[model samples]
Target: MLDEKLLSRALLDDDKENLMKRLLLVCVLGLTPLLISGCQSAYYSAMEKVGVHKRDILVDRVEDTRDAQDEAQEQFVNALEQFRSVVNFDGGDLEAAYNKLQKEYDRSEAAANEVREHIEKVEHVAQALFDEWEDELEQYTSQGLRRESARALADTKSRYKQLRASLTRAESRMQPVLSALLDNTLYLKHNLNARAIGSLKGEFAGIKADIDRLVIDMQRSIKESDQFIKAMQH
Candidate 1:
């Protein structure tokens, strides 16, 4: 009788532990979306605690986006050069040429992704800052001050719209370039022969045109970023 009683108690304790673990897992699953939604607010609150504000964060993210675009521009140029070299292959290891082109494609893709992330960050902070600014405008007791603030907000919004449009145009241009690079990479991977090189040479002109358009758009975006940054600082 005593042995049976002790066994029953141990089994109950084990069951309780398993139940607790299950409950914890359910809680984590339920909280995932809530945590994601609240993350930006939590970040802003924490930054405020350390004397940093949303405007400052916005400026920083814009700078990061600008830098990302610059790096992406260079990566795309390098990838174009690699593609050109492959198309003009003289006499060397086909595998080596393919490997170099693949590396360049990978680098260009990573740079494009970074630029996209930075742009998203900039948009997030800019929206938050504008929301807060609009909310605070209601607290102004003087009509003159309120009107001035409203005008300033409108001006900033106008400039931001231009900047956003430029960034979006540049970002959209990347997909064609990426698609061309990916198509070329896959083609070379399958056909590592002289005929493949000859076929790719025909594609080189189209790829070059796409890259040229992307570079022009990116340059315009970078210029817009500079202007926006200056406006914000002022």
Candidate 2:
């Protein structure tokens, strides 16, 4: 009986251990998104400690920002096409058409947000790299090396200023597009008829112009991003 009791207790303990392991695994899985989202600064600092500095991060983030902008441009183009289609609707369930346009607007907004987030990441890393470079200049023992480093830092700052200006202009362009999209979506949500479509038509030209300007700005920003990344690589 004593031996049986011990055996039963051991099995119970084993089961409890397994249950705890499973619960821990479940907790980790549930927290995955939070872990991924938390503390970019910590991640950057940890990477820096391991020799992966901010310059490398800046290059990666610039590319990411460029890609995000490209995606946003594509999404906006798609939304524009959808808007055109809705404006041309002859005889369909106007509510359904409005719903489709609304979905496109939502998608465009999400893409624009992604572009902004990538740009912010690029800015964050670039600022860190520039600040670190500037601070390290005082630490240089050799005057000649210090002067050379300072020159490089100044040149990088100039190029970065240009790049950041382009990026910010592109970001600013997104607002008009989003506003137009929201206006059209909201108008259609309420109207859902020929009059609503006609009303949107009057605004289409303005929306198109805004999109065209946005595209141009995004293209310029992308070019600047490529140039900056190439410069950082060297």
| TM, every model | 0.84, 0.82
- For residue 128, give model 2's deviation from the true position in Å: 1.2
Clashing pairs in 1: none
Cα lDDT computed for each candidate against the true fold: 0.83, 0.79
lDDT per residue (tens digit) for residues 1-234 in model 2: 211222233334443455443433332233574663454455555444434567766776787889889999999999999999998899969898888899999999999998887777677678878888899998989999999999999999999999999999999999989998998899889887788888989988999999999999999999999998899889
Candidate 1 per-residue lDDT, tens place, 1-234, comes to 211222233334443455443433332233575563456665565445434577777777788889899999999999999999999999989999999999999999999999987888788888998999999999999999999999999999999999999999999999999999999999999999999999999999999999999999999999999999999999
* Candidate 2: pairs in clash: none
Q: Where does model 1 exceed 4 Å of error? A: 1-37
lDDT of 1 at 124: 81
Number of backbone collisions per candidate, in order? 0, 0
